[model samples]
Target: MFGGQVAEVLVNEVPEDVYLLDVREDDEWRTGHAPGAVHIPLGTLGERADEVPRDRRVYVICRSGGRSGQATMALNQAGWDAVNVAGGMQAWEHAAREMTADGEGEPRVL
Candidate 1:
């Protein structure tokens, strides 16, 4: 998602306190992604809520903004800090950035 890139920029430009929380699936992750991102698929987030820290700023991302938006709302309702990565990875690609994918093959769109 775009937030991944924005967070990445902030991490470099405003490298004070920001974290990237990638909510993409495992196979999606195996493709390209931002550096220093923490892998935590959306399906497992609820069970792993405690694993996410509440002490710093957090930015959420997924293949598209929809899932991330859902996660953001859920986190916010649960009193955890989270924000949606607008445009998601598709948007990021539109910006002409590099994306990772499995070297073995490409993911088939259902």
Candidate 2:
């Protein structure tokens, strides 16, 4: 229902407890992602959409905005309050927002 916002400002627009859904692949997720983001690849979103909460805002992201844009449409159709994170992780990294890897070592954007 709204135009997507770039990752830099999107991080601040939503509250601290917002649901940031990362629709990237397993490998991409392991490489790096926005802290506290939930990992549910775009392909599995339909079956797993229910896992995303409704109480807070839901923002979807991918390596770029393409997959998250697709997810935003699907989630909205399924009655979720979702938005796309424009420029996705690329922008998030460019903005210097916090990024974390799978806990074993330092985070690196891939």
Candidate 3:
């Protein structure tokens, strides 16, 4: 776990039904991202926090683990159940998990 309080899970450990939030930038998101993820870049998450459901556990992710970790902490402090996807998209791609691209190219982590 990150910071000994924020929950952390590996890519393979994420449940198929969980709410996945991608906090990467626009360019990074265009490159590739999880199939069912909700795109709410970290910079705008504070204003868009209500868009995230408070009922279920939220799985936050980013290019690596850094940004997601921050998002997880913030969400948790704000009374949401959020877990950081450790190793982030890099690990997701390495594990051969499903991904989708914004454009016409093959989905890949940028």
Q: Considering every candidate listed, which one attains the maximal TM-score?
A: 3
lDDT of 1: 0.64
Which candidate achieves the best lDDT against the true structure? 3
Tell me the lDDT of model 3 at 43: 100
Q: In angstroms, how far off is 82's CA in candidate 1?
A: 1.1
Over the stretch 6-85, how does candidate 3's per-residue lDDT look in tens digits? 78998999999789999999999999999999999999999999999999999999999899999999999999999999
- Alpha carbon lDDT of each predicted model: 0.64, 0.80, 0.94
Per-candidate TM equals: 0.70, 0.84, 0.96
Per-model clash counts, in order, read 5, 0, 0
TM-score of 3: 0.96
Model 2: clashing residue pairs?
none
Model 3, 4: alpha-carbon shift in Å? 1.8
lDDT of 1 by residue, 1-110 (tens): 43342322212232323576778888778775555667799999999978888877567767767677777777777777676666666655555444455566653211
Better of 1 and 2 by lDDT: 2
